[model samples]
Target: MDSLRHHPIRFHVTHWSDDPFSRGAYSSLLPGGTPEHRRSLGEVLDGKLVLAGEACNPVAPAMTHGAWNDGLRAARIAIEAGARRVLVIGAGFAGLAAARHLREAGIECVVLEARDRLGGRVHSIALGPVWVDEGAAWLQQFNDNPLAIHARQLGLPLRETDFGQPLAAAADGTLPDIDAAWEALRAGIDRSLPLADGVARYLESRDEAVRRATRFALDANLILEACLPLESLSVDALDEEGVGAGDRFLPQGYSQLVAHLAEGLDIRLNRPATAIDWSGDQVRVADESADFCICTVPIGVLRDIHFNPPLPPAQQNALDHLGMGQLEKVVLQFDERWWPVSPSGYLRWYDTPASFGEWLDLTDAVGTPTVAGLIAADALERVFAGRSDEEIALVACEALQAWADALRRL
Candidate 1:
């Protein structure tokens, strides 16, 4: 907290579990990522069952907008098929979008969510006077993003923040120039010559000085932004899933977009569809049977679901190949702001590859003395595995202290 000049009073750690409803945070592609898997995932089974989620989206899979688009597509397919009653499972962004569009088209649809509340991954909690998003927080593409469009329409003010700026430097104070090295990396990737397996492998081929200098930033981007480990992320897929120029946060909370999308839709919470009997003419979910059904659950959760006739071998294989990304956030509320106030945010460590390496300055964003520490991939798994909230917080504080010490030395 010394780097930020803030003394934290309380800390809240949110660890999203790989469970019945949401197995992980989002979807990630493996090496040799193919669009065929996504296409197979989105295929309408027997014109009675349709899969709708970010995972089912071929163009923008694992994105909030992609999920919304998939929902729209699924709803349109059911409507065009003259389906009167549609069962939309999981009231996440995709399910909510499908329900909303289905309602607009005057098609009867019921949204069944396992959780008691809506906004699957887009969760927000109040920390004193300000609200902090514990789940999906930022809208990446701003003007062009579908979520941003809905936020603007709902009159939610967006706090635009440039994440490119760094608040703290490396302890050695010999940070390498990333722009030139990044260009070289991109050029190497463009050649499509058998580059190494992952980002870490590709970086290994670079000069020692260049690798050391770019290590911190590059690792941070992979884990924090991509929500995957460098070892698991494919070099080719990295370029394919490019980063957004700027990010916008909903001060009111990202759930507002969910609320807007869910307006007038029949959303039934606390109803987890355990079994689906889609073998006959009518698609059955729980006790209710509809002309068609849209399963918008995450791929991790889908693996466990019981299908009457079972999913096709190709679809099952696709689910097995696609991996879920893990991410955990630790939100700390301080008595006062002790850190430098930056319009964007703070990137703490230069060498740490863990999630806590980057801390978002929520002090200005939420009008409170609070910051969120992120952890993802293998680091998150190792640090948080079998650890309590208190233990996690202690580790996070120690990391912050270490970062503060480094800043002081510089």
Candidate 2:
């Protein structure tokens, strides 16, 4: 390692799990769980209520545009049910999209959000002149994404992220071609077995370094993407499909798309709907009665709202079975780029053995002079546990500095 070290001029760390409205980043699949659970969660209850969100969607569960699609789907379903007035809970992509769709259909729809802002998990903040996303950053699978379609319609510029290419470094500045191994990964599966078990079994024949590297690859890709601990990650997770292969970066920020979808909607911010009484013909949420209710509340905190007569056993079971995974971002913006400039949009340093598994080079993506590291599953809890923001930043910077030093030597 060399003497070259750098620290960011400014940074923003997110703790989405700590947020009351969004208990976790996204809904995950656990061992012995089926994707049908999501379909069940998306199902309308008693023809009077609908649960719509990314979690509820089986096709594209964690995507922002998926939430938007679900919202639109919910609105259509409600309209089909002859609903004149609808009350939408949560002003995220799903809720806002549903409200907009309903309004366009000449139906009265009011969106009630817990937070003062729009776009639930799609949060963004201004970093100088650049708008950086603190929550959902990438418009994953852009070509097929509905949100991407909207963004294009609105004339918002999007930069393509080359997720296929990535830079890697070890403590000795040696990086193995783990990408090949990852692509060739095959796990012997059974319903009782978790992803961890299969990975361990597969790595048993490899050397210690190879095993560690594979684990790192899994963490940086699969585990981080799922936001679930290895032991809990479902073996059936491989069955899930994304919108497409296009990964896009929004320079104007993810919120711009959210804003576009939210135009001309009855959105009431900071009005947390505590209860939804759907026992009668019409549903009454927070004292306002509506002919139909579309609850796009994140599945992580779905139980926070009191449902009168209780949700159906199938819906409750789906909520229970579906795992809510937590993944947080630590975004650092520097005065100048300290990291190496390369075509690779992602950077991963295993030199620290393991701290931050994956880093997105915003500098490369949109000339932000910034990088975002994702910490998920076990690492997320361990790193943040008993650590203040200052402490976390110190350690995080130390990891980056180590990586920089190693890369400098190379």
* Candidate 1 ranges beyond 4 A from true positions: 1-7, 189-205, 240-243, 346-348
Candidates in order, TM-scores: namely: 0.91, 0.93
Against the true structure, whose TM-score is highest?
2
User: What's the true lDDT of residue 254 in model 2?
Assistant: 89
lDDT of 1 by residue, 1-410 (tens): 23434346788888676555786788876555556777788888888898889887777776788788899999998988889999999999899888888888888999999998898888888877888887878886666678777777778878776766766656556556655656556665433433234345566677878777556656565555556766565454455453455677887678777777788888899999888999999999888899999999988788778999999887887776577888788888877776555556765565545447678777776787888887877778777989888778777766766666667676
Q: Write the per-residue lDDT of candidate 2 for residues 163-201, one digit (tens) a residue.
A: 767666777547767676566564433335567777777
| Model 1 TM-score (2 dp) | 0.91
| Local distance difference test values of all predictions, in order | 0.75, 0.80
Model 2 steric clash pairs? none
Counting only residues 3 or more apart in sequence or on different chains, how many pairs clash (N, Cα, C under 3 Å) in candidate 1?
8
Query: In model 2, which regions exceed 4 Å deviation?
Result: 1-4, 187-192, 207-210, 242-244, 351-353, 364-368
